[model samples]
Target: MTVSPAPREHDVLTDLLTQVGYRNEKAFAELYRRTSARLFGLCMRMMGDPDDAEETLQECFVVVWHRAPLFDPRLAGAMTWLMAIARNKAIDRLRQRPRTQGARDIDWDALPDTSPGPAEDGENDLAYRRLSDCLGALENRQRYCVRDAFFSGLTYVELAERMQVPLGTMKSWIRRALQQLRACMTP
Candidate 1:
């Protein structure tokens, strides 16, 4: 299960977001620092390409900076508001892409066997469950960074930017998380 932030954390984000509505650059920076990782994860999932995700994240923040005043705390939390913007931005980017870019001739009948045998299916299920439990053992931010880097295929530099951490810090987090996962799964 994912952990939700404490009320105090929510209040701080809310405060920063409110300040951002008033054109406070410092507040915006803090807000970005606190939220960018998760938002970038969402963008990566939606955009399916690191460059597109990065561009979408940038566009989302631009919209957030301009439309912060439109946020209604009664309706949603600050993160929710930001996520909506990121999601919309990702969708817009998807819509703007050339449809023909992904089009290709396919010989469907010549494709290799894609379905796993019973033994393989069982093994895959066990591995997935183990991986899920191991990932759950990680710190929330570290888990997010690992997922974004490995599952979304984002590079270290992209992960660092999304997480708003130094590249070294991002590398350390991923390394430690992987070590922990390995340890957990070894037995």
Candidate 2:
């Protein structure tokens, strides 16, 4: 007896995205439910203010709804495409902000310390450096695939097509690269 493999998360997201492209409200709702928190976190990191992040997240969904029909799974994965939209929206918001010529004279002690403490910031910096090193250790193709998939927002199918490799092979390369990174990151 043959047992079928469980659907991967990207595959489920891909299906939901396709349904959303058909203007299915239920699919859009489900997609929002599944991805909003992740996208919100991304927005928060980019915008650096809760209010701005909230606004950016709202704008992102609006664009997502209007552009869902343009999503092509062959070109990018659902999450990748969604993230690209969110990133672009955040950038647009940033660009619209009025530039200040000089730092305003303000009492620094009056403001609350919303940012991370020095120790925490150091840890975060160290983690980033470690991750960069781990990525650099990957095979050239695997590194390229991972960067394209997560940074450039390319889908596995798109990566495969661009790299002239089978989809499964591209997936395997990324999976193994991630595994290696995980191992390297562990203390």
Candidate 3:
């Protein structure tokens, strides 16, 4: 059996990001070329509408252009950091729209899958199974809080109030649940 080598910390993408920090137009263009489709797709899934997704995607790139100098490779990969920025932007946009009192709940099935992973189909299935197992290991309340807060786009305050717990306790439940998930999922 052949085991793959552990992933490296640095990559060409981060190297290009360093160049972008110096206001290198070429590097920025290259970075966009390499990453735009995936991030745009992420925006699509998170926003659940193409028009809004496109606008959010544009906003994300503007952020990249201005914040390139602040990119730190030690905490996360360049692409990972960019992806988080796009996600947070989408979430912020989601939270900005007015909620209807009698509106129906969000249809999770309609959302596209934004997760990235191995190129192989088998590996993708394995990773998902592992993730499901890790999620299943959590207490019911913790699982609900984590899933609801992320997919339902509910604020922690709302979740806490719904569950009849203090805000800090709600945060702690999610945080510890996340820690358990990380431990279970990590090799």
In terms of TM-score, the best-performing candidate is 3
What TM-scores do the predictions have?
Answer: 0.51, 0.55, 0.67
Q: In order, what lDDT does every prediction score?
A: 0.74, 0.75, 0.76
Can you rank all candidates by TM-score, best first? 3, 2, 1
Residue 17 lDDT, candidate 3, scale 0-100 = 81
The 10-residue segment of model 1 with minimum total lDDT is 102-111
**Candidate 1, 72-185: lDDT as tens digits:** 788776776887788777767765777544312222234343323222342345555797789888998888777655434456876787668999999999999999999998
Task: Give the runs in model 2 whose Cα sits over 4 Å from its true position.
Answer: 1-5, 101-187
Candidate 1: global Cα-lDDT?
A: 0.74
**Runs in model 3 lying further than 4 Å from the true structure:** 1-10, 101-136, 139-141, 157-172, 181-187
lDDT of 2: 0.75
What's each prediction's clash count?
A: 0, 0, 0
Give per-residue CA lDDT, model 2, range 1-187, as digits (tens): 9999987667788899889889999999998988888788767765667998899999999998888889999987677789889988876776566643211222222444343322234335556579878988988888877765654345687678878999999999999999999999998
Which segments of candidate 1 are over 4 A away from where they belong?
1-7, 101-187
